[model samples]
Target: MLAKVLEEPERGEFFARREDEAHSLVNLLQAILDYASLSPSLKRRFTSALIRLSSKSGRFPDCMVLEEVTRLGEDPVAAGSFGEVWKGSFYSEVIAMKVLKVYERSNVKELLKRFSAEIIIWRQLSHPNLIPFYGVYYLNASKTRICLISPWMQNGNVVQYLRREPDIERSYLMLDIARGLEYLHSGKPGIVHGDLKGENILITSSRRACLTDFGLASARDSELIMSSSTPNARVTGTLRWQAPELLNYEAENTRSTFASDVYSFGCVGYEIYSGEIPFHEVKSDYYVMQSVTRGARPPRPPLSLCQTRGLDDTLWAILQSCWLKDAAARPTAEYLVSRLRAMPRNAEEKTTPAAHGWDRLTRSRLSHSLVDHPLSCSAKVVQEWKQLSLFEDWEA
Candidate 1:
């Protein structure tokens, strides 16, 4: 099958074949590349073969390369499963260049199909809460290094921005994220942001959060290169933020759902307010998975921290609702938007020092709580299963 794909020309009948297999094709390549048992020497051989074949798979014409794309940097500023994102310029204006990793090497037919499809879909997307897609251009004469362009966000991702400016109003940011999700979920065929971690949520210059790295299985079909030791680190980070259904092996399907995204939004909320990832207290990814599968959720922030960060009871409850064990029990993104719109002001009035003290007094009397206790510590980062290829065949 691989050889058959390789024999096709850039404009041949093969590149025009079935489009839906794009994500699956990418997954097949990922399975080979991420196979842990492959020795480094053997892996390098496979990479070389892919690289050699990449040049032949090029499809876009020279005219397609945007003249406005001024400069592309040598080193990538960020990396992920899709590819490397380099800091660049579009007609002298700063921009982000999303250089995809799969197109150059992975299967040519499905990738071009996926890229063409996503380009149209991404182009049609117009929302204040989404990072707008500019255009695509070839970075080199070989046409192997194609880039998807967008505005350069100086504020960085939501997590990085919050950590740098700890005093920023978190509720406002959360609302931005919620509105973005609402826009996506409100679409004709609601776009499920399969990945919704803080890293994928960029903070615009206006200080609003905008969603990126979505579509094409949340862009899992391409390699967005990362600086991590292995690509699996991205999946590991995802595991910490995943919905219970996505983590459950007993479940027939583990594909990300709208409900799973809501659960991840809850994790992102924890990151925004507490400056920590969900299950930060747990070191082992496997253990976090184990705990979540066993009905355990991330423990709440300390009372003092919660009060300081405006994570008042109302806001905490909203976040808790997003993490409901039953997917159907979780609130929709639209519901969250409405609730968050009035949350900050109401929470402020309700969480005054006096109110905090009063809550502290009464909270102890209530035996029940909104969230579960943190799982007891048992292990650190276990090297036994360094790479989890759980999402390779994840449903679209």
Candidate 2:
């Protein structure tokens, strides 16, 4: 199963929708033929069939590949909303790249504003724990891309780690995140990580984790700017991790502060210990608003959750403080990082054996990039990346 998944992850088990359920995915005929690199005749036969299918569908598998491949210097390992994230190979050295999806954008004028702002925002800060952007590149006349050739974040995300390795050093991981956030929020301009959740954070190849995706980040005074636009572009962020204010749909009509971020961060903290969706008991955003506004509080963190995860009363209290309903009661990122540093020493986790999807090749093939990979990462990310062999070099 491991070998098969690595060789043909698209057809392997554990996909959200069954193969028959998704007919539009570019067929794997060509990739299969390429993997059979030893057989020229097989490749030729597959090529003929591929050509015929492309003629009918008006798309080719290889045609979907990234163009520049320069700054990244290699092909994409994972792809997402703005573009493909390629593995960078800079003058023999390898790093990662985030390339823009040209075809995905319709309004170039609007895209330029958002894209430029995102680039400038990332450039303003630097930390060993933050996902760093090497720089931006423009190829030809209309193409633009952001290359982040930093230390590759290898463990995937914290959310998935919670479920699979619920015993991982939570205090250690949280401290790493807090320290990075402290740097971001206490800077000269004081950047507030507008979107703080599990999915956006990536664990490094070095076993160290860092916060990422500051596209929505801003300073204390401008935190409210997140919902500054009407109806907003693409809902601003993931709904499950949204604060009560955001879950209420008054985003554009009201204001947000570091307090709002605190509320959201609380949910993120729960994800660390429970390894479950912050409010999995609820159904949807409307359900969330009904429950949280009516005082539906998450369960209290247990001593076991803290002990097993290498956290303590102080750090747990701090995590919960980030999630208080009233923004005023929530701790600032700077404070959270400070308190997190006081975590108690705990043993490392004993991870369960890999799941079906986390076995090999399937582990590296993240199903859809639009699932959101910023502002910490989703709860299931590390598990999925494990299945895809994304952390091929990392031990369990």
Candidate 3:
């Protein structure tokens, strides 16, 4: 049956058959190893064959050879607990390669399993606001150095980009993130972005914001809580952006909900507006966690600062609602998107009439002054001043 399926020209059928064969082969090997001991030579040969077949089974069809990738830097573009991200060139296109760190030999199997899972999740997601996954590749025959590839964002992460262009409008950035979260939450079972922070939001070459780093993400129905006994399963999200409920022992059994994500979104909004990490003054993660659980909120940026950036009271109110103590009280990602969508229109409406009225009043006063101050100046000079005022008004 496998041979016949492989002979078929249809790509879908071929892949389906390959997947079935791979699973059957794995089960057979496990059974043979456990209940029937084979000669070491025979077992090794079988394992090697299985590995070779699996590599070409189209699981990650876009997987590239080591020769296809060229590293552009000695140092990684970003680094964290899981791995290092390096900028590289793949087929003439700049790509970000995330290389997972290999630890002890005993843990390699588990790490590879996790890496495969991440790949599967990325394949399932498709959104403009989410980072685009290109393919996966191994650096050596040992398969020890696995790298996940994606398009590299030239502008870097949100925090870095904002620092460089402090005057850039952030409403669109916040809206992009909210749209990504909404898409994740709207999936069949819904995906919770367990880690949502400014660092995870990348700025694209087109100046659009995209969400990345899904190492901690999980389906809402199967959310896992970090336990002391399972250090590997511990929550990897940053303390500052974590929801208060995530810090409570009693809530461990409770799955992370859409509300928790909303809480994190609020923190990200603060970071985007203030150009500072949430709880920037806090010295330690533990302290930040404690303060969050105790209901201590980050201080609001001064109204003058917010106003200067076109952020008004209505937007601030939305941010406040996001951090409400009761998760149920927090607005949904969809709702936030709608509010953000209407914000620019709201600003325009509020300012348009007032600005027009002020302009009209100024022109009326100037016209009256020109009439009353008749021959105090030469007629040619007055006519020139009148033409200049008209030109300025027209330009405005």
Candidate 4:
């Protein structure tokens, strides 16, 4: 009977619909496996069935495979370490398509399985502050390449939006991010936005800040990012927002934690208020890593600029707490949500003129052209680049 069960195809759809029942069944099966005094052969067969069932039980309830999508242009609108984002139309509605870059020699099946695990967590999430996952579809028949679909935010990321509309209420933007983090951290295992930065925080048409990339990459993907030989675009861009613990070469606990996410949150706060990347003064990525590990933090923006941006002393203090060297000393996401919510709106920011000497800060930093910035590319050029296997050396 167990052999027959193993031979049968997994009923993913059935388990997807009855998730509670699936979980209950899993629990019952686990209990039985633990206590039942079965013969060796029967026990082995029962374990195999349980393993197969367990894998199917986590399927997304409403998994979608979008069949039709029209690319808006040839060049990608944005690029990331793992993928390039193309502006596309899906069923007459504007959407963003994140085309994942998978090398020809890569283990496609293993990568897809890992990505599917992340999607299982991503699909069930629903919040105003979170970017909505439209669905995913293969870009190729072999399923070597895939595209993730999400709504296109015309307003762009929070940093770009704030740069254009400097007078926008920054505290409210911070509140949106804090709320998003709170919601993510409230989950059972708590989803960590492993790569949180200005670029990952999109501004919706409604002008609300929504988090985009969260737990999309597995540990193996992180190894590539940390590799010295990897593209500078992937490495240095994220290093600025990374926590000290994550950057410490000597530290054994290098994995991203809730504390690390909080640290990135503070960096994001700096970017939103200052209109500059964290540690912009440091010209080199190597130095930035060294500085962070040595307990250095981004310098406080000028008091006048802070006032204009509504970043008062209290808020600055909160940001500082997030950067504390001791990970345990950092504030929780829940605490941050409450603290940001209770912050009084600064009336001075509304009436104050845009702060001076801000452009100097931009000029001072070395150009980070490789960083994921909102840049347009010609469709033809991007198409030609896509065909080059050398350009696809790594996978996300």
**Using TM-score as the measure, which candidate wins?**
3
Candidate 1 C-alpha lDDT tens digits along 32-77 = 5434355544443333233222212322211123544666656789
Q: Model 4: which ten-residue window has the lowest total lDDT?
A: 223-232
Assess the local accuracy of residue 290 in candidate 4 as a C-alpha lDDT between 0 and 100.
89
Off by over 4 Å in 3: 1-67, 221-234, 345-396
TM-score to native of every candidate shown: 0.66, 0.60, 0.69, 0.68
Which candidate do you rate higher for lDDT, 2 or 4? 4
Error at 124, model 2, angstroms: 1.8
Q: How well is each residue in 323-395 modelled by candidate 4, as lDDT tens digits? A: 9999999999999988876766734433533222112232122123112111122233234333542123322
Candidate 1 residues lying further than 4 Å off, grouped into runs, are 1-65, 102-110, 113-117, 215-237, 344-396
TM-score-best of 3 and 4: 3
The global C-alpha lDDT for each of the candidates, from Candidate 1 onward, is 0.61, 0.51, 0.64, 0.64
**TM-score of candidate 1 to 2 decimals:** 0.66
lDDT of 3 at 372: 22
How many clashes does each candidate structure show, in the order listed? 11, 20, 0, 2
